[model samples]
Target: MLHIGNAQIPTCGGLTRRSFLQVGAAGLAGLNLPDFLSMKAAGAVDESKAEVKNCIMLFLVGSPGHLDTWDLKPNAPADVRGPFKPIKTKAPGIDICEHLPLMAKLADKYSLIRSLFHTSSAVHGSGHQWMMTGHGFNNGDPHPHAGSVIARVFGQKSALPPSIILPGKVGAVGDNLGERAQTAAYLGSAYNPFFLGADPAKSDFKIANLSPQAGQTEFRINSRRKLLAELDAIQQQVENASTVAHDTAYQRAFSLITAPETKKAFDLSEEKDSVRDRYGRNTFGASCLLSRRLIERGVRFVTINHFDTVFSIACWDMHADGGSLNNTVQDYERHLLPQFDQAYSALLTDLDERGLLKETVVATLSEMGRTPKINGKGGRDHYPPCWTNFLAGGNIKGGQVIGASDKNGAVPHDYPIDPPRVLATIYQGMGVDLDQVMMPGPGSRPIRLIDAEPIPELF
Candidate 1:
């Protein structure tokens, strides 16, 4: 009988009741992409120039250990060094985990920020808020995800939604501490990121929201629009001002459900088998390929959440606890690393082939990293003290890494950059002057789109 906003949450459950309250309120601002697309169709938003625009984010759900992934330690002790070895990358001096061979080959195209840290709460939600929204928060005040912010500022492009979260939205991590950064907070429900509820990796892959029911035709749709128009006339008399907004919302819903181009953007069948194989036929891999399709159709932002749940899946959290969450180095080698390597390299190659590389930025990020010191279970615990995240393409400078971590990959030794700088760099890469573009706050106050400055070296 515990209450979280309007939703009832289990009070006696493992997580706190307060967390459930946050969860209940989280989905309240959920957005509809088709509705946004329909609005675009009605000329509600601008689609002026065919500017080079696109972004694909690979969000490693469970934070990967920096020492194991981007920053390897061969000289350190056996326990500290862990299992993976460093392999020389195409970037010459740069070396990444051996398991990521495909990524190593394309290392010249991407840069790894070895020195990155934030002293936020050492929880998964903390990093999710940080990497996803570019700010750290202890208070439960929700913030907009970078993609949603992009949507609020740039609006929709063609029939596709401006911001999209692939496969599914972020759910309960280990903690109920709300990951508010993913929501479009004060921007309202109109600007929330579109959540693709189904997994792209499944053989029966389909965008549930984009799918139309059998026998539903244009004639039926047009009739529904007429009916809605009549209803709008009635509502107009009851609430004059609010009627316009509600009508706009209704039209948006129709456009998405009836649009042909929007459906194609979500259809994987349009892609070649070889292309699918190149991206790796797995969940994260297929999602990357789908992102490319969406970008081709003018989707402004696409995020591929690596995995939805960290409990049963063999995720990046290598806390080999010998239980359901027990993910060892073997899991990284056998599945995660290779899959990411293939998908990421394929996305880079594909985007470059289509000449979208210069206009699109690909960011590989995580919540945080594992501890510098190995735990008793031969796995590393959560460590936010230091880690690594990287950006490529768009206006980002590749080939050379910007920062460095100390020995054993413990802390930032030079140019300690936080998460906001990374978000700022993305905005800059997208040709948005962080100083120029601003969004409205709760009280209709103009708030700076991002409070931080872009990493100069990234450009």
Candidate 2:
């Protein structure tokens, strides 16, 4: 019998499956394998069937108004229609905001879902929970982020974490509860999205978590690993499953810190200045560019939070309050729309040129949409009735709008959609059979990943 930490294997021969699956301290701390890897090794998952291998989720933290952006009601009252004029695109009958000219040209590369709505509270936190996790958990049993679910199910392909979120996690957006929605709640800490704490656009951008301690060298790290191994052996016997999951999380962190390839994946300096300029060289743009690099390097899931917060910044939350959260139409016309147009269009072009777009789905999501009627303060407020989000690349069929908003853009006038259906569609596009695959729910029970079916129109 061969005992490797908590994983005990019966040794029969040198070529036995037990020996092949042996996870020693070095394997756990130095090699690239999460809990999902063990499941794959045991034939629990077949990765070969996944047609869409990767996903790049660009989460627009503050929701953009459906009327002002994708679903323009040109014939409606001026108050409901807003200021932006619609422009034609390559895809016939599809016209987006004039501010998104670059995106307009590439309309054939993406599809819009203009009638998405949720009946949850209109608060930003509730919307975040719904769109990101596919379940509204105001009752406190929060669900995991979609990327975290992917990390747990798909496993890692390289030293890079299976899921990576660039810039940082979602921060304060009206309610404090929205921030926790970005976490892996029931899926455990091991599958949490790897938050890139620093801005990649900065001149001195560095991944702090990937760097070793101030006084630590390779030899010192190795020495500590030996000591930690001795301690982990004793700790394993008494700790619960949560502790074991924490150890797996630590193993992932250790592998990332020691691996040279992982460091190179986060290095923006290697990219040409021209490419960086094409991505716009700002925080959001650079993050989008970095998402491509990470995806190119075998990251299964990459999330780029366009803005981490809505306070004291020019974000999508257009309250026009004349103070903090004072984003107006000017912000959209100047900074928000232009930057998104540049970064998003560049992402599509770069991915397609590199032949990655065919295998990687890029999803643009948000908390919720702004109010259909323009506010007295010349901005829009939070409205949970309807909004727009989109998906492109991968196996997604582009160049068409799936649903529609009413004449006033108040509610769904056509095919009404919700958050879970969107997530189910994304999962199906990733080649996951919703009927066959199930997640390990709370209390180790088998439960469906989502309760809804995929949007048939998407595929």
Candidate 3:
């Protein structure tokens, strides 16, 4: 069993089954593969309809520098154009970073929103809140992560948790801001997204949350469950709202512990070597492949945080300062670009070949973009004024660039779209009707999925 703070979970041997139950109560939606098809057979969630049901969100934490990656400006002055040259894609007049060669080949598979912006503090957590929850509220008044919201609204379809975040949740981003926004704020802890604490790329990888204790036998687990049932019986003597909640939690615990596929979902060795190579046998790349796996098992919203921390490791936030957070253009060409291209392209191609692409919506999002012009450090500064994000699969239109940035790759010259629209568009693609399907919010008020409407063009 791996020790996580106070809990010594029996994760290694039988933890996946237990962890699945421990996730939450009555929260399910989004199913994958055998489970999804089984549900379709059982008349649960339909697969024949062209509804966008599953999501694989690639959260580019620490944010990618817009100038170096998506919004390349080769014609600008030497400093403005930066070091890398822009390469044309299959789509005419649409150029991306030179290092994204694989992505260039798959340009027709996704649509780029070249003008996504948000008005939030330049701090990473603030932008995370804005993009994650569609509102940057504080801990005292937290908002649900987009995945958590989907969980609360739709409900689970299989034993796997409805919402999941791979490689763990976001942590310390300079300040002690609301890092737990990945939770269901006023919606209660029962709706939080299930977090995968271990790195998928590691050779000895195991889902930390799914590992069982060293000496924890299945019989012992079953015995403990019975004891909890009896203790809950004692608590129910004076039954109240909280007691009822405890009962539901207990049931969820047992259900997960008893599920077999929950164990299968975390078993990467079950995949072929050729498949693993296609996803690029790296941390971020493997995580992307796992996201597809979880979705295939009935997970609703699967968020793959490309990197948990922006420091030390090669990430997209090309600060270029020779320090902890430094990420130069060299890193982009050799590490970040190729890693992302290989992984993302593999995900799209694999999903399409497996016949899952048309039923799932895959999105690439970031907190915000970097400056339009180059910085003194030979990189770009934070720029909330303009950036780029993309959406594909499901009901979204492919082979299109809906918005445009100015000549310098600065602010939007036309059709200035913000982050909220991205979330709204995702909902629309996922078969969610914002005008209907109201979710209970604070004070038991029925709140719309999001107040904003989905971008019509994404359809």
Candidate 4:
């Protein structure tokens, strides 16, 4: 038996009962304590073997159209080409929409993948599953998100969670089939991405999850901890692996609540007004700024959902149906493109200036691309055949276009890249050796993190 304070803990298989009790107690606090314990048990992360220290994933919820954005066809018909004209970027042959002027100036900082496609359904959820998890949903066996996989492999570096999603989790958005992909899935709940349920852009923004309850003082919290420990001592009689996992989560929650560094990490007020303004004052901008802060504070991965859903908003899903989903070219020009251009460019510049770019990988991804031709509603529809996403910083070479589409911007005219390959490339960029590294899959079976090989050209 092992003793902590006034409680006596039994031993099981060389592990003290007090440790298991603490894990169960921490689990009650809503932190995935078991995940850390599991990683320690499996020896997943080896510091000597680690490569990239961090990553920020800017997930554009609604797919952007290739013709209207990156791979614009200036010589195509008026309806097919859309209104915006491509302008020369800093990189010699590359040009993007005129609205993305800020991004155009920083062309040498990033590389565009013009031929990303998947053979899955065109629904938003399907693409979400594929792009986020690197796997198509097979019945209900959803794959773990890339971030969750990272969290599982590396564990937390500080009191703050390793994987975090800003603004909130993706909801609704046409279908819910792939929504589960955002979760830890078979890797277990301990590796789930920490979703910041509040908007940082708001004047009254506060992380409700990180803040203590009203009138709850440090002394009171400590008293409650003691009480919980006493209760855990009693409950330890029925202790099991699940109970230990719960206790571990509670321990993590307690650490987060009391840790000044965790509070400082999430505090945006520390940033200058000018700095905040540079990223833009909107939700997306604030999220981008927060992502930088999180990365600086030892978060391995931060995912910024540009928008939580595609319905009833001026999102990239430019169906232009003139209904709840009425997003048109005007919205893109006046809002989406400009907002993204500022936030993205600012993030890259900020990271580069802070010298974090070399240690971090910044990636922009979407579910799919918009259709090649314009629709009757003056907008493009979903097209899973082809689209454009980009990568920058870390080991990724900048200012180069990897793949190409035909004149109509319809299909992959050159080297065809799929969702898994893109994900594999990201892992590779992060210094993960796909051949040597394996993750624990369903039924505790060891399995490859991803099946596809990384893009050779990227190296």
Pairs that collide, model 2:
none
Clashes of 4: 17
The Cα error of candidate 3 at residue 241, in Å, is: 6.1
Across 1-459, the per-residue lDDT of candidate 4 in tens digits comes to 432111223334465656667657767876453343443423346556565768899999988887888999999888889999999999999999999999999999899999888988998999999999999988768999999888766667877788899899999798888779789887767677889999999988888998999999999999988998888777756744455545656666787799899888878889999999999999999999999999998888999998998989899999999898899999999999999999999999999999999878898999999888999989999999989999998888889999998888889999999999988988888887776566667865557778999888877
Tell me how many residue pairs clash in candidate 3.
22
- lDDT per residue (tens digit) for residues 1-459 in model 2: 432212333434444565455655437665434443334322223456666788999998888888888888899988889888999998999999999999999999999999899998888889888988899885677888998777766777777888899899888787865666778777778778899999999999998888987988999888877887788777766646575577667677778889888989989999999999999989999999999999988788899988888899999999999999899999999999999999999999999999999889899999889998898999999998999999998888899899888888889889999999988888777776676566667874546678899888777
Which lDDT tens digits does candidate 3 get at residues 213-322?
78888888889999998897777677343454345446555656667888788778899999999889998889998988988998889999988877787787777777
Pick by lDDT: 1 or 3, better one: 1
Across 276-327, the per-residue lDDT of candidate 1 in tens digits comes to: 9999888888899989898888778899898876787789888899987899
Q: Name the candidate that leads on lDDT.
A: 4
Candidate 1 is scored at a TM of 0.86
- TM-score-superior candidate, 2 or 4: 2
Winner by TM-score: 2
Indicate the worst ten consecutive residues by lDDT in candidate 4.
2-11
Residue 112's lDDT in candidate 4? 94
The reply for model 1, stretches above 4 Å from the true place, is: 1-52, 214-217, 230-249
How many clashes in each candidate?
A: 2, 0, 22, 17
Worst 10 residues of 1 by lDDT: 2-11
The C-alpha lDDT values of all candidates are: 0.77, 0.83, 0.76, 0.84
Residue-level error in angstroms, candidate 3, position 278: 0.9
Better of 1 and 2 by TM-score: 2
Per-residue lDDT value at 65 in model 2: 82
